[model samples]
Target: MSKHVDLPDLIPVFPLPGALLLPRARMPLHIFEPRYLAMIDDALGTKERLIGMIQPNEVPGKKAGGVHRIGCVGRITQFSETEDGRYMITLTGLSRYRARDEVEGFTPYRRFNVNWDGFDGDMGPTERDTGFDRPKFLDLLGRFFSARELNTDWDTLKEADDELLINSLSMLLDFEPEDKQALLEAPSLSTRRETLVTLIEFALRSDGSGDMMQ
Candidate 1:
């Protein structure tokens, strides 16, 4: 993260269910909706080119889902417009924020007033997971993937550093929205790793029982 770059108090938010973007990670997004396409265009014109990635909460009585309080702010690092007028963009996570309030706006997409108090650490170096048990975690991951029949580059995953490996899995895994939110809200990398392990274990235990572990 650049020391000179300042995060905006107000930012456009993309409420995607089950999407997780952590600091120092990159997320590729395909923007086909008119509102989000407009958001991409507007973001490109800004200096920071920032957009907040948040998950929607499933409200029982509400017709539309409510946005989660916590989210990650990412800068538009790579972008290209397709022939069909859709956008293919990659966002590099900068910091995590807590939404203070939703700002009523005329822009098709939602915007929020966010606070970046406890997440200053997110702007720093990649967090080191001191207690990360690589062998154990990888073994669990392999079984979990096998049960789900999900294919991955084992060599690349083995070669990845602690932060990269954990964050990448947290993003790539087919966890439920609530599980992803829990992982996103985890205060430390180690905590997130533990939460991930638990989620995977639960999925594996529930596999083929028709219980449909989220």
Candidate 2:
């Protein structure tokens, strides 16, 4: 979807730390909770068909950032219902939104008043440093994945466009929730790629400074 979606004032949010959706990327979700199932059902019935993916703070008593102030908005592009009554769906990201306020809702799920002004650049690639050290990034990725004793098809990994690569890695890797959110909130695709590579490099360092204490 090349066109930016008209921002919505309120959206049903799925709060799961470590799960992220970037504009134009697709995130598959399995919905079994009664409230979320209802949320999906309502989305499927609506013309907009959107869901917000946000991370909540894991630290006990940190309610302020518990449900992050920002999130990505995605439209349901595919949907299926299981015999077990769960909903399987794929959300194609539209844009990132900031949660401005929580509005009272009649449904079991909660809704948030969101603002998209901050994410105007999400529609497409913006002017970014195109020469941000791809070789070093790939090299660090090699070391990081190798240390974990994992193998990847370097051929495929090399072919994905930078945005896909950055967002995909940011989602697939075991970065802390805040770290992942940092990647999500990166100012530009270029910055996100740099941040991702730096995070990997830090993780590979023997001293393990990448360890952010929860």
Candidate 3:
């Protein structure tokens, strides 16, 4: 089965570094900055609150650098206005895109013309642990936490479904920017799971591994 959606040529893009959003995951964004606030207004006015969440290849404040080629488009599904003049919005991932051209304009926030050429649409099938090795992964997390005396909600974690379980674990585990990017850019659930395994193993060998894990 194929899943498809029409993608516009001009789309509002938010280039936020160090923030990674996976498919089927809800990312809550607090729009406080003036530029981003303007972005929200534009999106709302058009009734097309579709924004591509991309990361800067370099630091954010150093005059926005080029963004990663691959990014996901999120739609504003939930929003709220706060008393302090900020917007709390939760974006749900819809599809992935490739940046075709960067739009140069007077807008403070960035915008881009994108190409959805190779987007496969649907969130691929859930990957089952091929080695039946979840036990080892579980053990590593437990020991990794005990060694650091870290406080974690084991009960809640155990109750989560596969997608939530992996995503939550990825966020809680100490992964480098590059490692996190790898997970974000992973095209399939199986690949992301593999990356998580490697990260967990690396954390066990590093000093004060908690710092290196998160």
Give me the candidate number with maximum TM-score: 1
Report the Cα RMSD per candidate: 3.0, 3.9, 3.9
**Model 3: per-residue Cα lDDT over 1-214, one tens digit each:** 1344355777888887667766667788999999999888888776557878887777567765778887878788898989988999988776677887888887888888988776563345544444435555566678777776788888776766667778666644566767777887776666777788777667767745543322
TM-score on alpha carbons, each prediction: 0.94, 0.88, 0.82
Compute the lDDT for candidate 2.
Answer: 0.81
Worst 10 residues of 3 by lDDT: 121-130
- What clash count goes with each model? 0, 1, 5
Candidate 1 collision pairs: none
User: Per-residue CA lDDT of candidate 1, range 122-210, in tens?
Assistant: 99988999988788888888888888888999999899999999999999999999999999999999999989988888887788533
Q: Distance from true position, residue 114, model 1, in Å?
A: 0.4
Question: Candidate 2 residues 1-214, lDDT tens each?
Answer: 2454566698998899789888878999999999999899888888889999999865676655458887898999998889999988999888888997887759898789988876776776533458656666777777778777778888888887777777878888888888899988998888888788778777777545343211
Candidate 3 regions off by >4 Å? 1-5, 59-64, 121-132, 147-149, 171-174, 208-214
lDDT of all the models against the reference? Answer: 0.90, 0.81, 0.73
Clashing residue pairs found in predicted model 3: 173-213, 173-214, 174-213, 174-214, 175-213
- Candidate 2 C-alpha error for residue 57, in Å: 2.5
